[model samples]
Target: MLDLIIRQGRVDDEGPLADIGVRDGRIDQVAPAVREEARRELHAGGKVVIPGLIEPHIHPDKAFLEQKMPNRSGTLEEAIRNTAALKARYTAEDVRERAERVLEWAVRRGTTTLRAHPDVDPIEKLMGVEALLALRQAYADVLDLQIVAFPQEGIIKAPGTEELMREAIRLGADAVGGCPYNEAGITETRRHIDICFRLAAQHGLPIDMHVDFADDVDDPRYTTAEYIARKTIAEGYQGRVSLGHVTTLGAVAPEARASLFELLAQAGISIVMLPATDLHLSGRKDRRTVRRGLAPAKELLAAGVNVAISSNNIRNAFTPFGLADMLQIGLLLCHTAHMGSPGEQMAVLRMATVNAARAIGIGDVYGLAAGRQADLLVLDTERVADVLVDQPDRLYVVKRGQVTVTTHRTVEVHRGPGTRSGERPAAGPSRQADRIREGGVPR
Candidate 1:
């Protein structure tokens, strides 16, 4: 017998409705009618069924540190300095507690796979990595957590960080991470990238880095995008390197930017745009008409470069707000990136689902197709096109074919006596005389 069957679900905006059958933690069949019997059944009720959201880049270790230390200057420099002070007091228990809260929030919000870049510098030491390792095992059934030994501090300038990074890998870090822009100068930054590539080579792990995060690459240190691109091509590491927060591309000269796009596409590198943190921390120096410090998402997509969006930090010094919600972040991108059109909106959705899956190297087994791992979500919206516009609730979240999260909300709108027009009531019913009882949500 099948494990589960989700009935009458809309899988595409223009296609007919489909039913998905799950067996042995994998999708067995997806057709208009799943005829086989199942142990359990979920009624989508004509809602949209989509692949679970993937967070290609996120910082679970540093989440919710905004109140502890605030960045009054509202600059990347100050955010790092403020977070460093808090990191000094971190314990495994403390990190795990905060990370667990964020992970739970992410799962409820329909994130099935998350790539967490936990800081591995001297201040936090290995506390973040250790804490996340435990979380990986704890949430393995419901979430896929990929840990990166991220050196938020400069690898070359921060002494002994190299040893700490190697130790983090030995302790089970999934990928090698770098922050070349945080180094002392251009030379040290280049060395930082070299060290990261060398480490990944030694351990046979993928590479993700925080590269060129400034509003503009006026400083030589922030001009390492081309270098990293060439290095990826030379090392034959295509499709394995991911870069986060390269907002400088938005400010680069158009002609030069176009060339860089081609190079990135050629090297098969993925650019993960952290819109929440990027829009917050970038362009601090602009005095008039501040620029949107986001990566050139539209231009990059036209060049056939892989682009994805993520929440880099949550309620932290870097970004003061987040609910660990991918749709909220995607909607923000839709607004700031001028992607309000229907086609643009669909592209934004793909950035969160398909592009993100490829970014973290999980595309092979991570979609809604038959024989793929059954990680899907049934949203509380009927049409796939309205998924973003409606910001619908994830009524059901399935991971490995097992139901993980289910949300049920009920609302009743009661109109007062002699209500005119089709307008909604300004206030809910306050007195029994004006109240009307109804079941389910008001249409």
Candidate 2:
């Protein structure tokens, strides 16, 4: 017998209604109707079912620190300095508590995976990594958490951070991370990138660098994105290197941006757009004319580059606001990136789902397909087009064939004026109300 079966569900938001059978924590069959018997049956009632989305980038250790240390300056430098102060007081327990709260929100909102970049600098020492490492085990069933040993303070400038980053990987980090922009100067920043690549090569891990994270394309600080893209090809890290933030691409000369896009596509590098943090921390130095420091998603997609959007932070000094919701991220991205048409809206959806899963190298086993891991979201909306507009109630969240988070909401409908519901008194007994049946129920 199948472990679970979900029927009358909509896939791709608009495809033909499909029924999925799950067994042994994997999707067993997908068809218009699944007739086999099952131990448990979930009636979607024509709800929308989609692959569980992914948050390709986030900093769980630094999450929820906005209250403790606020960044009044609202600049990247100030955020880093203030966060370092908060990190100093961090203990294993402290980090885990905050991280757990964030995870609870993410999973409840239908995010089944996250790439958590926990700092590994000397000031924070190993406290953040240790907390997230344990969280990886604790939430393994709920979250496919990928930890990155992020040298947020810069490996070269911080001196001992390189060792700490390596140690973090040894202690269970899944990937190597770096904030090359946080380095002292162009030379130090270049060297920091070299060190990150070297470490990833040594440990055979993927590289996810925070590169080109400024708003002023003319500034010399926006130096590492092209360098990282070129080096990715030289070091044979294609398809394994991801760059986060990349906000400066918007301000660069169109020709230069075009060249960079080509290089990124050639290297198979992924661009993870972090709108929450980038739009806040970046462009802070610009006074005369402020720039909207967000990645050029439309241009990058036009160039055939892999692009995805993520919530880089939540209630941290860097972002100050977030709820770990990818649809919210996509909707905001649509506004910032000017992607509002029907096709653009759907493309933004892919940014949070398929593109996100691929950014973290989890696409193969992470979709609403037969034989894939049973991670899915069932929304109360019948059409995929209304999923975002309605932000439909999430009826069911299935992870590994086991129902995880389920929410049910009820709406009271007044049938007619004579029914005296009075919820909408302005139009008491309209012709629409005449459609109500004799039992005061809408037909």
Candidate 3:
């Protein structure tokens, strides 16, 4: 007997309907009709079924800290300073509570995998890592949590951060993270990147870093993409590195930018675009016609470079608004990055699924096909192309063939007799049935 079966689901926007069979926590089969029975079954009713969403980068431990200390200047500097003050008072219980809230929001929104970059600095010490280690085990059934020991404070600028990062890895961090642009100068920035690469190589782990997060490359520290690319090639770390918020790349001269893109492609490094935080904290100095602080996503994809999108921060000083929804962030990118065409829109969706899986080093086993792990979503929309435009509800969130989250929402319009268009009806209480969820039917 199979574990579960999803019937009459459309996996493609222009393909025929299919049935998916799940058994032993993996997709057993997918065909025009699954010819076997299962202990439990779901009727998709011709709705679009997609692979589960993935968040390649996020800060769960420091999430929801806007209320504690706000960024009054709305600049990256103020955000960091404000967060640093708040981190000194962080407790295990406090971090756990806020982090759990973020996870619950993510699961309800159909996210099955997340890579959390918890701060590994002097103030927080190992508090964030310890809290997330427990969460990694507790939420294993519903989510695949990959924790990175992110040194938000520069390794050289902040004394003892390097030792603390090692301790975080010893406590079971999945990746070694860096913040090179936070250093005092370009020289320290290079040393910071060197230490991150050495740590990753020593431990046989992947590297994910925050680099070039400014409005322009006028600062030498923000222009380290080329240097990092060369280092990646020399160290033979191809396809094992990811860089977040390369916003400075967009400001580089056209001639230089093209060459940088080629170098990045040759290095096989993935670019994880943090649209929420990048758009929020960047371009602070611009006055008239402010620039959109974002990496050239369209050009990066055209250059044969792997690119993905992530939320990065939620309700924190860095990004004061987010619901932990990848689709919402994709739509935001579509608007800001000029990815509104049909094909471009589809690409944006992929950034949250397959592309993101590749960024977090889970591409081999994450997808919506037979032999892949049964991590998928049955969306409320009927067409795959409409998934982003409609912002439909995730009717069922399946993790390892088990239904972990289910959402049932309905809406009905009621009209009284003799109520004509452009005419006012009786002012009595009208009986209109509407069960709204998450901003009332997405429009």
Candidate 4:
């Protein structure tokens, strides 16, 4: 007997049909046949079953303030000003309510885990972390919420922030974070990052930073990514650090990019690309050629660095649009980063699922293989390729051997001339399945 069984599902719209068995909140077997009795069974009906998504970067404290105070110009500076004003008036109840709305949507969109960055400077006074901590515990059964004590306003620039960040970790934040570019200069920015490193080491937690989010990446002083990569190696925190919104990595001088990518790979650091927010808030000053504000994903991937995508904000000033969907983020990445081929599509999906998990050090415990946690999404589509274009039904979402969310899709062609909505005649598998080869539905 098993806790639950998922019947006749495909991994990525390819390969032979297989069944997944779950017992004790973990995947027990994944094979062509698993004839086992269980407390519950989900008839996948040939839908694609994927591991639950992970959100690597977000600001739960400043989510959904699009209408409260608007940034007329979608520039980064204006966003910071607008959000600072909003954060000043932030209450625990308000933050909790907004963060809950975003988290609920993310969960419904197939995210089982997320890393939320809440402001921890003196102005916010740890209110954001406190609210998210409470919400984390409340949603523990369904969502794994990890909070980052982020100094969004800068530490040296806003003296006394280091102390608050220390308190934030003591209050249950899982990681240390910083926005060093918000400081006075690159010199102070280095100190800002050093302070975060010291804190992460002090509290024994991972570090996630917001670095080098500029439209143009040429700087005579220094780029934050290079300094941070060097620091990761110096502090012996390789593989334990992630950088979010490093758009400058994409904009840097072409000659400089390769060296920086090699340095990042050497340090075993991960990059979380915020497509929605970065695309919106960047290049305000460029009228001739608008900047795309994206990292060099292809170059980074080729350099053997772990590059992931994330929904950074939900309807906030930083990003006036988002629904907490990693697929949506990945779709935007596919367009902006020119990842249109079938192999690229699989890589894009992995950015949201596997790479995001590795960013937070949860890859070993997450995924669809045997012995991994049973966090899966049975999407309602003939093949996995439709997941991005069709927004297909989320037939079932199983978390840890238990079903958490489920839905179905129904359509009809009304028997019109040459209409073909129903399954094809005498189909062992749809002809469309022919295109779905090597774990993909080829274009």
Candidate 5:
């Protein structure tokens, strides 16, 4: 017997209809039919089943820190300053409460895994890091949270930031983070990168950074991220480095952009695009023909560099919107980048699922297939295009073989073609079997 069985659902990647059976928190069987009874059966006759989505970049710490002093001005610098002001008053309990709320929203929206960055500024007493670590422990079963010890306020520009980053890593942070462009100078930025690499190698953690979010074209210090990528590859740490929000790369000259792309691709550095935050934080100074200020997603994808999109900050100091929905982000990408073709849409879908998983170094533990954990979502849609266009409600969310959230679909009654005298259609196997044989549609 199985713990749960999803009946007649269309599997992702355009596969045939099958019943997915789960037992002991793993996908036990996926076939045309399962004879054994199940404790619970979800009827998904006209729906689609897909693997749970993963968001690789987010700021749960900023969510907690910005509760009191929200960003009024929409500029990136104003958001940073406001967050700094708010971080001064943060406490462990306060951070935990607010971060928990954001995680709950993520869970309800079909995101089971996330990589959240926590601020490591020393003057704020590292309250953001402390709060996220505590919350990660508290919600271990429901969510797989990886905390990035991020120096949001530049690693070298802020006082004692390097020591605080080390302190956060020692406290069980999963990765090392930095903002190279925001540092004082190229030398300082290179110093910060060296510190991150040293800590990551010593602790066996990954490196994720807010690389370059500015749009200044003449700045030479913007190339520190490429330097870090090259050094990481030379030291034999390929695929363990990720660059977040490289917006300035989009604003650089064509020759410079090509060179940067070549270096990143050769160094195996993944790029993360934050659509929600970039739209809000960038291009504030341009009066006419404002730039999108986002990284070149299409170009990066074409160059064989792994690129993924994220929600970044949700109702936090950076942006007061963003609701943890990557589908919405995908739609925005389609509009902003003019990726309206069928193949391009499929690529973006993969970005939200497979590519994001690879960005955070958790691809093996994800996806919908045999030998994988039974974490899946059943949506009330027939095809991938329909799911993205309609944004239907999730009918069932199965996590580790248990039904985490289930919403029933309402059925309506209709008169048969040849009904007579208040008599209903036959309800025996003959009628049911005939309907099945004829491939009857669900009511």
Candidate 6:
């Protein structure tokens, strides 16, 4: 007998109706008819099933700080100051608690894997890093959380940051992260990139850096990210290397942007676009007209370079409104990037799922396939456009061979024909309403 069978589900691949059988934490069979009986059966007749989405960029440490500072100015410098204040008062327990909360929200929304960057500046003693490492072990059963030992402050500009970043990696951080553009000058930024790449190579870890976030194309000094990518390739490091939030590329001269794209693609560098954070940070200096400071997503996609969209910060330090939902990210990308075409929408969806998995170097066992892991989500909507439009409820979220979360559909009742004046039908309690009445909190 099969461990679990999900029938009548519209498999993402090939757009066919099939039953997915799971056994021993992996997908056993996927076909039109599986004759074997199963221990448990889930009916997914009117639902769309796709692989669990992955988020490539997120700040999981905001859950830990006691002081909740707001970015009143909404500029990068102001955001940094606010986060610095919060980091000053952060504790290990506080970070652990907050990371857990953010992660739980992500999983319920169909994000099973995340690459969370925790601030590991010189002032904080790597408290965020320690907390996330502990969380990785605590939630290993249901979530895949990778920690980036990030220097939120400029790596070379901040005092004693190099040692702190190396220490974080020593303490089991999965990657080395840097913010080069935030440094004072081009020379300092290059120094930061060199340090980050050197440490990554020394420790044999991946490099994921927060590149330029400027909205001006004439910022002639912002090319350290390209330099790092080239150097990383030349050094014979064959691991995953990613660049997060290269927003300045959006404003660069079209010719320069195209040239940079070629260089980055040749260097085998991937990019993560944090739409929410970019929207929050860019165009602050403009009074009458505001520019969307996001990277040239459509152009990058056209060049056959992998681009993944992510939720950079959640109701925490930098950004105060995020819930770890990739659906929301996709919708925002559609609006911000003018990706309203059917093909463009599908590509945006891929950014949150398959493309994101590629960005984080987890594409081998990801996506809905015959022999992949049984990580899937059943959405309530029929068409992809409807799904993005409604942001419908996730009917079921399956991780591994077990059901992680299930939400029953709520049927809406309308007024019947020949109804009496001011007479309404007696309202029956819904499964969700009953659960809410009974204080059925999310698991």
Q: Give the TM-score of candidate 2.
A: 0.92
Each prediction's total of clashing residue pairs, residues at least 3 apart in sequence or on different chains, is: 0, 0, 0, 0, 0, 3
Which 10 consecutive residues of model 4 have the lowest summed lDDT?
A: 434-443
Query: What lDDT tens digits, residue by residue, belong to model 5 across residues 1-443?
Result: 88988888877434478888888888888887878899989888958887777789988766744556777677887888887777777777777787778788777777778899878886565787788888788766667789898887877788888788888888889999878777778788888888788888998999999887877656656656578767978878888898888887787678776777877888878899988888888888888989888888888888778899888887876777777887777777877877676567667777777788889998776777667778888888876544555667777777787777766676556676875646656664421112111111210
The candidate 5 region of ten consecutive residues with least summed lDDT is: 434-443
Candidate 1 Cα outliers beyond 4 Å, as residue runs = 418-443
The residue-by-residue lDDT of candidate 2 on 348-381, one tens digit each, is 7788888888889887887778789999888877
- List the candidate 5 regions with Cα displacement exceeding 4 Å: 35-37, 64-72, 256-259, 408-443
lDDT of 3 by residue, 1-443 (tens): 99999999978754578899999999999888988999999999999899899999999999999988888989999999999999999999999999989989999999999999999999999999999899989999999999999999889999999999999999999999999999999999999999999999999999999999999878999989999999999999999999999999899899887888999999999999999999998878899888889999999999888899999999999999999999999999999999887678788888899889999998889888789999989999876777788899999999999999999886655677876645655676642322212111110
Candidate 4 positional error at 205, Å = 0.7
Taking the tens digit of each residue's C-alpha lDDT, what string does model 6 give over 201-286? 89988889998788885554455656866786788653378889888778767777777787777776788999988988899999
Q: What's each prediction's TM-score? A: 0.94, 0.92, 0.94, 0.93, 0.87, 0.90
Best by lDDT: 3
Lowest lDDT 10-mer window, candidate 3?
434-443
lDDT of each: 0.90, 0.83, 0.91, 0.85, 0.77, 0.79
List model 4 lDDT by residue over 78-160, tens digit each.
99988888888988889889989998888888888999999888789889898899999888877889999898888998888
The model with the greater lDDT, 2 or 3, is 3
lDDT of 1 by residue, 230-300 (tens): 99999989999999998888878987877899999999999999999998987788999988899999999
How far is 409's C-alpha from truth in model 1 (Å)?
0.9
Which model is ahead, 1 or 4, in terms of lDDT?
Answer: 1
Global lDDT of model 3: 0.91
RMSD of each: 6.9, 6.3, 6.2, 3.1, 6.9, 7.1
Worst 10 contiguous positions by lDDT, candidate 6:
434-443
